[model samples]
Target chain A: MKHAVSHIIPNLTTLTASQTLFDMVPLFREIYAFRDLLWILVGKNIKIRYKRSALGFLWTFLNPVFMIIIYSIFLKILLSFDARDPLFLQRLVTGILVWQFLAMCVGDSLHAVLGNASLVKKTSFPRIILPLSTVLANFVNFAITLPILVVFLFVNGTTLGDMWLLPLVIASQFALCLGVSLILSCMNVFFRDTEHLMSAVMLAWFFLSPIIYPFSKIPEAFQRLALLNPMCGIVTAYRTAFLGTDLMAPRLVVISLLMSWLILALGVSLFQRWQVNFGDKL
Target chain B: MTTPAPIIDVRNVSKRFSLQQQRGETTIKAIVVDALRGHGKRRDFWALRDVNVAVQQGETVGIIGSNGAGKSTLLSLISQTSQPTSGTITTRGKVSSLLELGAGFHPDLTGRENVFLYGAIMGLSHRQMAERFDQIVAFAELAEWIDEPVKHYSSGMYVRLAFSVAVEVDPDILIIDEVLAVGDASFQRKCIARIDAFKQAGKTLLVVSHDLNTVHTISDQLILMEKGQIIATGDPDAVVAQYQWLSRETACTAETKEWGTGAVKIKAARFLDAEGQEAEELQRGMPVRIEIGYEASRRIDAPVFGFSIQTTSGILVYGNNTQIEEFDLPFIEGKGTITLDFSALELLAGAYLFSFSVHSQDHQTNYHRLDNGHPITVRSERRYEGVCHMPVRWSVGKGK
Candidate 1:
């Protein structure tokens, strides 16, 4: 009976692919089975990215410092925003540091799946591992940049309030970025237009979120609509935890937490469903 | 005893590729094409069609096919790199596939770094890679350059490292494409020995190679594919014979053919360079040598060895003989060599077929004649055009 059935179907290649697309249990299991690959890819990404530079991974922290100085000069001198505003630097630093993880992951993973099409064409493993590792590597960089926020908090004379909730905020943002990265990267393999359109969309997303601008400045109606962008709630959460700012529409945090995971699940499902044909396309 | 469920089972597998969208089209260009063509033409390309096969454990199956016959596609399906458009392929045990040269290696990373990275990509644990790291470096003979970036390594070195990693990982089923031909003779021999060990073990192996002799000897079972379908299967010798017959029926192209009498025999002939390195390719204006190794079964009097260079279209470019050059050997016995040396090969950038023959100085008795139409490519950097390069100097001042 086993011999007859083996002729009918075959081994793990067909067995794993036989599962329904919605049955993500196999995917998660494969991910767990290939966890070492994820870590190594993450390590590889980091080393290849930074090894050529003289400073070597120090740029993770140094990046935010450079941005902070440029933004300070742009806002205070060029825009003539009052330097007397204490909370301004705190808001800027929190927003930029948190936002960097999302930008970097989306950018890197944009090419992660497509750039490694040669590997994809030859080898078979969980395709999700590519984007997952990219996001995790950027998260490591995000962790490294957090100290810059600590220095900024001191400079602003802001005592950390509700600081423990920062982990939840980080988790929410990670899910959102991973989801977006996965979608963009997967689509980039097929359409390639996704990569070009993504840059424009990200620019719009950055301004829509209250990174440099304060949330209170927006009109009430626009503020409610802006909350639909998960980064709005995410950036606000960072400011709330660090600078003791009011969490406008307190459910925004919960929305962020829920919406990000929703997108992440959607991204994972679509990617797996479509990846069966990825090798053919590549 | 039951045959352990046939380790690999591929059933009625067919892969279809759509022709609507050209592959590797840039997004902007794709969008433009979409707007311009607007689904003007639609056709589906069948890369594989109703291919089926089953193999027991410890079996070595060699797949032979002309280009684009879907041999690579079938291997991809078995390795689970791509799913078939229809049908199912089941492969048991750990399947390690070496599909192409320089598989997924980061060109910027050092050889040491890429080894670890590639191990992980092949789903090997860090500990496994670490354990075999030394052996991989040693087997590839790249210990001296392991720390150097792989981009700097030659193609031969790159293939050596990749082959070492795949073999050392001890996979249950090994699938190799045509990467084996890249390494030098000794490295190739070392790899063949390791592969022989794999065969000695109970592991399954699938090899795809254009070198019919290697495949015939290495594989006990052979699969011959044509036009995305299996045309022949079973014993390697029979299948290879069928493949040869079929190709002969289809293509009446002549290759190296030699006819000789019983006196003298030409054993081997090869092209060499000034440094005595065996030459695969040559550059214009480089010193070249054509050495013919011959054996006289019995004493032969006044045998003349001749060499000819011809264009692929059968146009003879140069022909010379020992008798014509007035270089004579009274008699030759046992084994000896006839060397044709060129201070500078003046042929331009193109391919040429070589011919070697031996006969009596009187041209009455033909001991051997060989028309070797195997094309050898000649390269040149200078922009001199035509079938031959001539040294020239230019003085452009008219008043002078």
Candidate 2:
């Protein structure tokens, strides 16, 4: 019976099945083949974010500026600090803008896979592109807001010191955000509670990163502990770029770069390990 | 002469899903409870088991089954949207599947933008998509509205654009799952014509549908699946015949149901072919004989006997009575048999319910009636649109 049926059918393709976990080579190849799709997803995300709003892309600029004004007003009344000082204001605004990029990227990444459940179930592509596009969309927003930082520097009568270092800092920050996004997006696919858990984690992460206060405010004994937070080096580097200050030491930059790369490695491996379960689980 | 190789080969493939008792339990409390339960609350479900299939180039294969028969699971496996738990599936060339319409479409994006986006998802380069953009829009017949957001398009228009892009991607093997049922009748005709052209171009096609007529018309071979196994595979008519029999046997057993005075009870009814052997299945345009065994408790004068054939959906396809034909039986008593024969059954490919009854000569009272009589299946090699064939032909001539 089987032979009769087999004769009626034809054979033009061949496949072999095996369980392959932690196989990075094929994963990379698949992602590379789907690179165009990654870009299109990123474009869709960014377009949909600002498509309907009246202010549109203006929100990317107004968001950081409004946060700076609010924080400065509250601090001026409560702390009796010199909020009028141009140097202090410049550092504050630049730090918040950079921190906004990181927070928004990680925050959106948490829901990346869950939000595209329909697409995930219908088509097969590199699962990492969903989270990766979230990060890239926020990066485009950050790029759009960079001119605001430049305007702030000029208004404050400050010069960009070691301007070439800005690209390196942005690249490091992008890697760090991409890494965290990859891990959190995969976790959120399996666990609905991850969305709530992430908000609390980001709240704590914001305070630990020294975005509001300068790095020098920490006591010498606690400076080493604060440096362990990767964002410490990142925020400080932004401040150094704007104010031409010597706060971002060489050792701190190295630590942050190494930490970002390590996290990225871990995130990619974990993403590949969990991606096979996505279609079944989702 | 050497035989050419098949385009798709699947062997002994099976898929198992681990279903959790409590879905999406990611809280700390749930995790702790699950760990303590030692994974005992989870169950394994095998959607497919040791199924194998192969299709050569240019062959259009149709898969048919009722719901939950593992049709979708098998398609997903072949399309590589999901991996099987065991065995191997290998295919040559690119595989594009329209598992669902507008699956990757963003509602806020314009139809034009979604064309590029969907193309990329299907593994087309930006330049390649741009070159085919006009052709895709034209095929969908949405040239004027291509720039409008897809959310504004009607559901039919949305599906048209999605289907257009899927077929335009130039895939070597196309897998479609119940997507041809979308769009208006005219558009459906156009889509069928396009697919026919695609088949002529020597691309392998795999389709899963519940519409038996569509399957019968398009497929070179048919596969009938039940409970995660291919029960029958071969000629479309034969497989459909098997499917009809299996479904009828499972759903309605004990086909004989009678309610009358028991004066003239129909003991049994059987359908036979030309050779006179009992046959429940017969082909279209073939002769059929229905033998009715009856036992009468009392003699009846001028008894009228007849039969009615209704499609499975209860639409009466054919009916005849002795009184209607001006023929009468003198009497019927004790055990006896009557036979009705059709020189050639013009019924289409479907299952039909046969009912036999004996009434008064004046056609007022039914002495005995068998409402749920024998169910017979008719298989056809040619496609017929409606319930029964009307026996028509066409000729072309110049109009003046």
Candidate 3:
């Protein structure tokens, strides 16, 4: 009788399990494997962006600062808005900060696929990580701007009652931005016109999200429309968390969470659909 | 050793590529409209179709083909870089494909980092990579440059590091596709030695190479592919012989018009050995015979037959015939044959060509000449150096 040889070495395919969550093993494995590459990719983008800029990291701080000044002059003073209203400027700045984070996330991610086309064509890896890493790097910018936001609030003589909620609000804002960035970056692969379309979309999204004007200023029917937009609830949550309870709406928070998950599911599925064909088309 | 079951069983695999030359917005829209109308506006090319192959454990198989014959495409399918459109590929080992040098390498990262990065992509554990880290660098000969960014390295350095990491990661099945050609000759020798070591250790290897020497040196089996299908597969020597015959015939037909005259066309030619038999195999320094058959348009006088032997790289190794030596024979125009016998085929182990030309004995141009002539298959029983195999013997003794 001929004896069969047992396989001592496992195949890459065998290691991949049938369960969906098991796929995360390779994702996490690859993350750990290419950690150095990830760090270098993020580091290089940051260094090249601010390399010779006179202000360096202060430029990160200056973006929101400039926006706050412009908003104060045009929306607060020139327009004769009520500054004395509880956390009025704070509420406005919360919206602006979220908008700034959104701006950085979407703007950087729009070029993620185009910028790394060489890597995509030559090497095989999870290409989603390229755009996701861009989002993670921009998160550093958001984290850096937090102290500035805190100092401004302190100078305005505001007191914190439920400060722990700020992290939750920021986390939700991140989820929202990530969901949108994922969708846009994948779309940019098929349609080269998506980058330009993103600029126009961001411009339109800015006005629709109550960044320049409060949600309350809009008509009742329009407010319902605004509430339907996930950014509306996230921005409102940020305002309520920082402003110490002027308009804390938990119902919209629940709605926003659901909306974020929906966007994430849609974004992930869309990305996965194109990923199998990416190596060929790219 | 043949295993009970092949570790990789590829069945009826085929990949069709519909490549669009233009991808601008307007072009894409036009294609979409055309697709909607049940028409494909893109040019379709079959990269591979109905290719069946199986690789058993501890077997080293070499895939040989001409350019665009889908050798790399087959490797890609096995490595899962791309999927086949029409077949199933079931593999049972941990496959690590060195598809391109430094394939997953980040230019901005240091070599140390890129190693770990590529390791993770290959599904190696971090600790496993860390354990092999020093060995990888030592093999790559980049101890000093390991901390430096890979972007600063030369192309050879890049391939060395990449190949080192790939081999060090302890893969069960390895797929190498022409990456050895990227390095210098010395590095190529080193890579070949590494591959030999891997085979010695009982690893399965699938190699695609245009270098027939390497294929002959290392491959236990050879797969000959043509036009996206496997034309032959079996013993390395036999498959190589088939590949040579096909290549020679193809080369002969391609330049047929330039070499043969319409007046008296040389239809085919064959080479034979001393026993007066059609020879498919010949040893170095052995007598061989050449037979040329022609269909004539008109009768000619004092016609002489000439043949030249050439190395595969197109260097004329030896040429002389009755025409050049002033020997002549009469030929009728309708149909005839000629035979010439050489005492010994003084050639090395490689494919050699024998082309024939017919001319008048007086050195004037003749009515019929076949310059592409016929190709003779040559193989030396003993591996010899240089263009022609010189007869020699050696003895091991103290220097006298």
Candidate 4:
């Protein structure tokens, strides 16, 4: 009977691809199984990122801090933009911190596979770990910049109204970054054009996000469209929850969170499917 | 112990590839025209065709073939790197292939970091890789450089680390294709020892190599392929003998050489055994006779009758002339025949080139020559090996 059954299955030669969602369980288990590899890969990228550089980890903090200062000057002095509430610059800095995380994740994640094409073509590990590791490494960079967000709050003499929700917001943004990065990284393998196209798109995405300007500055007609940008909701929520800004819309946050989860699940499945056959194409 | 079922069964598997050759398509116009007319299209190439083999658990098999003979393609199919274009190959147990070392290495990552990354890629868990990490570094002999980025490693060091990581993973079914040719001799010896140990532990191995000695040492069975088809398969010694015979019989015809005509013309040539029976099969350490017939348009004196036998790498194994034998023979006019009788051919199993030549004895200049004469196949008849199987005496340790 065993011999008979073995002859019946076609393509059984290929480790028999999983047809059901439960199949993802083993894949996830496999990813978890290689957690040290995941952590070490993330750690290695972090180490090599600053290796041989003078500023080292200080550069991580300087990037967002410098951007916040530049944008603060541009908005307060050049554009003469100020909220009647008197905490305008603090709110803008909050948005920039979140935006920096989003930008870095998008920027590095697109080349996650191409940059390590050697690893992609040679090893049979879960390919998602690559983009996941990039996101994880970027998280470390984001963590160093978080202190600045708190400094902005302290300087503004703001109260932490619902600041306890900051971790949840950060987690949501991470999920959203991973979901989008996964899709882009997979696509990057087939179309190298995605790498260049991504940078241009992200620049436009930044302006559309409420990072540089205030949400109140936008016409209400376009407010809904602005909220649709995933990072806009996260950044706005961070400003509201932490610095006591009133820009948060719970409805938009919920929508983006749900969309993030949906994209994450879909992206994971697509990346897994494409990964199994990558050795052939790569 | 109960006999194991054939854990690896490959049946009637074929892999076909589509090769595209486009001409004069600088602009979009050519592509549009070709797409419209459906002409000047891609061609189908069969890298492996209708191959069938089964290995019981704990078997060691060697796959030998010339370049583009589809050796790598066959191993790739078995390893599932690429799906077979047709038929089936079913294997049970974890499959690991070392098609090329350092294939997935990240240059920017340190050796230690690459170990984990490479481990995960090869499907090993963190704990598993961690447990073996020290041993891997020790085996690769890169202890001091483990923390340095892999980009800084020399070519030999890279292969050493890559190979160490691969072998340490311990998958059930291992497929290797020409990956052992790197590193120094000591490392190669260490690798061969590890493979032997793996076999002793009852692992299944499929090895593809041009190093016939290593293949012969490690493999219990063999398969020979040519032009995408399986030509022979069986016990290691028998299959190798047959492959060498096939290689030689077709040496003139085997597609290994492209024939050309210059001045003197080779009429007919064939290989024969000592009994004068025309045969392609030559036994190692046995006399091999090569006979050739050639027609010269003009008279030639003291012609340096020579033949050169070469390997696929174009490495000359041996070349000599009849003048060295001190025989003075005169070539009259039209046609003549020459026969070379050897006391014994000591070459291990390999394809060798044979050619007939008539050079100016005084000047040693090429007059009229057939560089690749009729092909002569030589193979090992004895179980002993090395570049040449030398006659030796041995003494075994005493037993009570």
Q: For candidate 1, what is the DockQ?
A: 0.24
Model 2 residue A80 CA deviation (Å) reads 4.4
- Segments of candidate 2 deviating more than 4 angstroms: A1-32, A72-80, A83-87, A159-164, A216-226, A244-249, B1-5, B21-34, B101-103, B249-279, B282-308, B312-316, B319-346, B355-374, B379-400
Docking class of predicted structure 1: acceptable
Top DockQ prediction, candidate number: 2
lDDT of each residue in A222-249, candidate 3, tens digit only: 7666676888777767666666644646
Candidate 3, after superposition: displacement of residue A176 in Å?
2.6
Error of 2 at B328 (Å): 9.3
Give lDDT tens digits, candidate 4, residues B1-400: 9765577888788876654321211234544655886854656778888888788779999998777899987776776655666776778766667776544588987899888876665555577679999999999999999999889999889988887877787667788878788889999999999898999999999999877778977999898889999888888788776666665644333234333332345676678777778875577777777777777776665666777777644567778888888877776457878888878877767666666676666845565566554555566555554445667788998898
The positional error of residue B270 in candidate 1, measured at the CA in angstroms, is 32
CA RMSD per model (angstroms): 15.2, 6.4, 5.7, 5.6
Clashes of each: 2, 10, 3, 5
What fraction of the reference structure's interface contacts does model 2 contain? 0.48
* Local distance difference test values of all predictions, in order: 0.79, 0.80, 0.72, 0.73
Q: B39-101, model 2: which lDDT tens digit per residue? A: 877577788889988888899999988777889888888876677888888886667777756
> What does the lDDT read for residue B315 in candidate 1?
62
Q: Considering every candidate listed, which one attains the maximal TM-score?
A: 4
| lDDT score at residue A256, model 4, on the 0-100 scale | 57
True lDDT of residue B179, candidate 3: 80
